[model samples]
Target: MAFQQGLSGLNSSSKALDVISNNVANASTVGFKNSGTVFADAYASSLTGAVSKIQIGIGSAVQAVRQAFTQGNVTTTSNPLDMAINGNGFFEIELQNGGYALSRNGQFDINKEGYIVTSLGDRLMGYQAIDPVSGDVYAPATASVDTFRPLIVPASGVGAIETSEISLNLNLSADAEVIPTPAPPAAAIDPSDPLTYTYSTGIPIFDSLGKEHTLSFYFVRRSDVVDTTTAPPTYSEWDAYTVVDNDTSTLTHNSTIGFDGVGRVAAVTPHVTAGVTPPTNGSVFSALLGTDAVNPNVSTLGLNAITQFGGESKPRELKQDGAPPGEISGLSISRNGIIQARYSNGDTKDVGIVNLTTVRNNNGLSPIGNNYWVETPESGGFARGTPGNGMNGVISAGQVEESNVDLTQELVQMIIQQRNYQANAQSIRTQDQILQTLVNLR
Candidate 1:
């Protein structure tokens, strides 16, 4: 009976040591969770199905092993795609067999197919941005469990949007002399000849096929100071002429600007061809392939910041909304787990929205290695959402979560389990010695 009790104690202690050793071994593993072993005392039942108060216990038996899901220490990494959860939730993964799994490992990379995947080629699941213009279209703030799919980056970069709006800001010289109307075909507004225009600047614009076209703006003083009744004159006027790619036929709108005596703008009329109505304000629309101002206003030239201060004409700022094609330059992840890709053309857009999952019983998940755990009966159902949505947590980019295992604590536990094993073995030995003395029959 003593041998049986001692043997059970040794078995339980050995199991505890095994768990401790595993914890120590995975102390440095990324996104790893440590587990603890449980033990239960064994007892013999009486024939009457009731335990006697004086009865001795049969020792201990291995009961259960529970994993701790407490937060792990975050470690900074150089990889831009690496992520860490600041609170709760797990990264959803799509396994090779079309099954889903959950993980905390944020070390991810883009595979040959442009899919965001782990080292083992399992795809990271998320709500993909299918339309470049309008990103993820989930009904809820976070995606539903069935709505999530594998995330893939556009390796070739997003398609180029034709230049639609040109925001122009500059000061026109107030002291410039008015240009006389071209008399008898006297070289009418030649862009190459600086004498034909007061001030001119050119900006690159993209076409329907991502073709680069130069759009030049020439400001010609239409009249000198008018309305002399007030101080410093009351009004001045100017005409703006546009040429796309040195061709006057591309756009046929000639707009005008009037400035008050204080060098402040009075009103501006956008350019428009004959039989075409203009827009109310500065808004550019694409005029690609037979598109007209009334139908496809390819680009809007903004002159809201234009003024007539008494100084040399100079540009304060100049930028266009269109870009000529682009390639992937970099990647970033937001607190809400929105992964974005940057392009060389200075365009940034969402590539995917990472999906997070939570179970009613986290401890019931079944570990299948690689920092992943599969759902089990006790884990219940998955409540899915993005970062900061519902019970999910926000993500931290360029960081990794270190294993929660405590090396010092595991080491101390190892020592205690070893002592218990030895003590149990000694108990069995003493029982054998007593049996031998009885056999000697003194």
Candidate 2:
């Protein structure tokens, strides 16, 4: 009985030492959790019944090993894809075998196929972005056993956007002299000839195919006057020509532009000629074609904001809503775990949202290899939520969580276990000596 008790103590001390050694070994590992060994005493029962007092103890055995799920320290990294959770949650990962795992490790990178994966090739799971067909984002109904999908980035370039509207704000020079004589007819006006027009500006427009074209606007002051009594006489008529490239046949010539007594533009009438060929796909055009094969309204020249002021002609604001195809420039994540990809064309798109899952029984999770944990019956099912939602932690990008193990504490425990093992060995040696003495006396 003494031998058995000594052996059990030795085994328990060895197991404690192993646990301490493991904690010290993984002190530098990322997202590592420390474990503690528990011991329970074994007792012998009589055949008839166990006595209330005077029960004999046989030995000791390992009761259980409890894992610590405390928060780890976060360290910043240069890798933008790395992430760290600040509170209580784990990043869901999809294993190669179609099973799922949970981890606090956020060392991630983009795979060759543009999927976000861990170092061991397991794909990170998350909520998908808006669907292309429905244009609606997905919202899960509840947390379940299988509510995860692998996160993948769109590799192709962001698609182009056609120009839909153009806005212009300009100040025309009021001191400019009107044409000495009647300007040439719309047919005779030449965009290349300086005498044909007073002011011209070029605007770049995009087509459905992402092709660019130059839209040129030529303004010619007319001889007609609306208020000659004003300090600066206001012109009642001006000829505006809309030309695409140098195609005179497709020109919108002799459009009327009128000004009030105060030199404020009052009315604009754009003219469109018939029987003109459509602009080529890749060719530069001076005017954008509308649905009816006519030049679209390319200016807000008639707005009261447009004034012929006594200053240098200048456009205050010129804006267009069009963009060319763009390549991926970078990626970013928000505190709420929404991942966005930025493109060269100054456009950003939602790729995915990282899913944070918490369990009711965090200590009950079974640790598999590679700093990962699996769901077990003892561990209550996932309490699914996005980062920063409810009790979930906010995510930090370009950072990782370090191991929670404290090396100093583990070293101290190691010394204690070593002393325990030595004491148990001494007890076994003393018991052997007593038996040897008894046999010698006999």
Candidate 3:
């Protein structure tokens, strides 16, 4: 009986050593959870019907190997795809074999196919950017498991948007000399010649095919032809011409701008042609695309905020609602798990939202190596949701969670386990010596 107890003690101590050694080995592993061994006493019933209060315990056995799910320390990394959970949650990953896995390790990168994948090629699951049927980008209302797909960066580029509306705010110099009228049949002004126009400004505009064209506006101050004796010099006039891509043939010079003495614009007369009709206030000019294009109608260009001031001619604000095709320049993950892709054209789009799954019994999950866990019957079903929602944790981008194993504590426990094994061996040796003494007596 003593030998059996000593043997069991040795076995239990060995198991303790194994657990501690594993903890120490994985101390540097990312997203690693340490485990500790639990012991249970072995006992047997006496042959007598009545139970004795002082029954000796036979031995000790391993009760369980409990895992610690405490939060790990986060280390920031230079990689933008690296992520860490700040609280409770796991990133849902789709395995190559179509199986689903959960992990806290977020080291990821874009694969050759543009899909975001882990080091092991497991695809990260998230809500897709575009809706197949509706062709609309995914939003909060459209988030769901049904919409979940592997996120892919647009390799080619984000499609172009044609120039639709432009707003211009400019201050024209009022003190500039006015140009006299040309002969009755005035020769068409050449844009390259500075004498043809008082001031010129150029802005890049996009076409249907994402092609860029410089839309130039030339302003020429005109001599006041209205009588000034009876009227208190109330207004100043300026003839404006629109030219596209240095093509003087496309130039139209019928637009006129009138400003009051205080430098505020009072009236405007936009150019009118067969295919072009500017807005009533002459503030909006239309750009005509080729007649064979899908939408042949003209694109509106707004210049309503023009002012004739005494200062030098300058553009205060110039903005357009068009964008050329853009390449993916960078990526970011928000605290709410929204992944945004930034483009070279200064445009940004929400690619997807990383999905987080929380289990009711994290301790019950079965570890499948690679710092991943598989759902087991004891773990219960997973509750899926975005990060920072409810009990789930928020995502920390460009960061990784380090192992939770404490090397110092494990080393102390290793010493204790070694002492335990030694004590158990000593017990067995003492028992053997007692048997040897009995044999000598015989």
- lDDT string for model 1 (1-442, tens) is 7898999999999999999999998999999999999889999789998989988888999889999999999999999988998888999899998789999888899899878898889998887635447543222334665557888877566666776668888999998989876887565477778887899887887765566778778889878665666543549878787777787565443677777777876666655643344444342323433343223435666676788898799998888887767888998999998887788988887767888889999999999988899999999987777889877889999999999999999999999999999999999999999999999997
Model 1: lDDT of residue 120 = 87
Candidate 2 residue runs with Cα over 4 Å from true position = 1-5, 56-60, 129-148, 167-203, 215-286, 289-318
Q: What is the C-alpha RMSD of each candidate to the true structure, in Å?
A: 4.2, 6.8, 4.3
Give the alpha carbon lDDT tens digit for every residue of 5-88 in model 2. Answer: 888999999999999998898999999998999899987778887554777677898999889999999999999899999999
TM-scores for all predictions: 0.84, 0.72, 0.82
Which ten residues in a row are the worst by lDDT in model 1?
285-294
lDDT of 1: 0.80
In model 2, state the lDDT of residue 404.
95
Q: Rate the local accuracy (lDDT) of all candidates.
A: 0.80, 0.75, 0.82
Better of 1 and 3 by lDDT: 3
**Ten-residue segment with the worst summed lDDT in candidate 3?**
225-234
- Which sections of candidate 1 miss by over 4 Å? 1-5, 129-146, 174-190, 223-234, 247-253, 270-297
| TM-score, structure 2 vs. true | 0.72
Report the lDDT tens digits of candidate 3 across residue range 93-147: 9999878989989899999988889999999987776756855454345567677
Question: Candidate 3 versus the native: TM-score?
Answer: 0.82
How would you order the candidates by lDDT, starting with the best?
3, 1, 2
